[model samples]
Target: MPDVPLTDEPLILDRQPLPDGIGERLAAQLRFIAEADKLKTILRASPLAAADRRENDAEHSWHLALMVILLAEYADEPIDVGHAVRLVVIHDLVEIYAGDSPVFVPGAAADQVEREEAAAERLFGLLPADQAAEIRALWDEFEAGRTPEARFGKAMDRLEPMLLNWLDGGGTWQLPGATESTVRAREAGVVAGSTSLGSFTGQLVDEGLRRGWIRPDEA
Candidate 1:
């Protein structure tokens, strides 16, 4: 007898219908995890000492949201404060992947563009199609720093660190060899983003000097 021929049909793995509302539930869970993961990045970026307590991503988002509420009056142009708040919340999510690049680090600043772009792709890819697109757009808008919302969001980013350093006795700036000119140059982004806040930052710098939080070079 000739050798028996085997069937050509492929074997099937287990098959079943998805549970009720499974898609919705799964999406919700993914969103929660994505949001939580972002918190990790923000805390890592924040330089707050362990004794002083660093603000995590979630706290940073909330603080920016509050700033939108409290400082709307200072915006240079009319802004959708609500939209601005949303921008701030998602702006740093990419840091979860790229890690926070401090503004003062020369190489860190130079590499930020490529690192952030890659991070945005991975971080925002976690959401459902529509949500991911929406968030990615918002992140892009903030990076462009063109629209009023983006401008304000960028301004807040600068303002927060300046305030933190000022409050914490030059928290990060107090490190040996940190200089006023360097601090001001790092903060120039605020002026480029929002003139109003940039002016405020100048005042803060002046205050920082008077308070001895920072020192002028050659002093």
Candidate 2:
């Protein structure tokens, strides 16, 4: 978003005066919209229930938004569904740049935190300054997971992939180090936002165990 020539041709300050009202705001917003298209290419570890290929970040974010609409009533505390939807969608825009870190794979990305922070800054900074800060704040709220909306958003975040795994013939459950116990520990946070979702996630793991989809880990 530097002040380079807005035209297709090379820089020419003297070339016919710049348009009377070229809107920087619209330009930045359009750039962000175009950049977000890359999320569709950033594939995740979880498989789609109906497809053979892994789910992409854009698909994952859409599913989370739908979950907020359908499942917000199940939250442990009352939540703002609209706000929660925003959190879940904005939560992964960082991954558009930093890329995804698989939750089931231990040590998948050692510097995931650092990478995501930098991604957040660069991606959101594509917007107008005020809008950039606003969107980034939503991302930070989801990461903090303190507010009611954030907690439920976090719950949906963990639950979606687990649900997909269950529906997709074990999905990521077959990854190295994945086990009933470890999955439970990682996904139990779903309960922190919604006891029902927590219980449902437990049921999925139990089913995985019964069907021999995931191994039993004692450690």
List, residue by residue over 1-219, the lDDT tens digit for candidate 1.
Answer: 111111221211112233455677475445546444434435533455335665665667777788877887788889999899889988877766566666554565677788778877766776677877898999899888878888888878878877777777777666554679887875786786568778989998988888888778775
Off by over 4 Å in 1: 1-21, 24-35, 41-51
Q: Alpha-carbon error at 163 in model 2, in Å?
A: 0.9
Top lDDT hit: 2
Candidate whose TM-score is highest: 2
Reference-based lDDT, residue 48, model 1: 53
The clash count for each model shown is 0, 0
Model 2 / residue 161 / CA error / Å: 0.8
* Weakest lDDT window of 10 consecutive positions for candidate 1: 1-10
Task: Give candidate 2 regions above 4 Å deviation.
Answer: 1-21
Candidate 2 whole-model C-alpha lDDT, 0 to 1: 0.83
RMSD per candidate (Å) reads: 11.8, 6.4
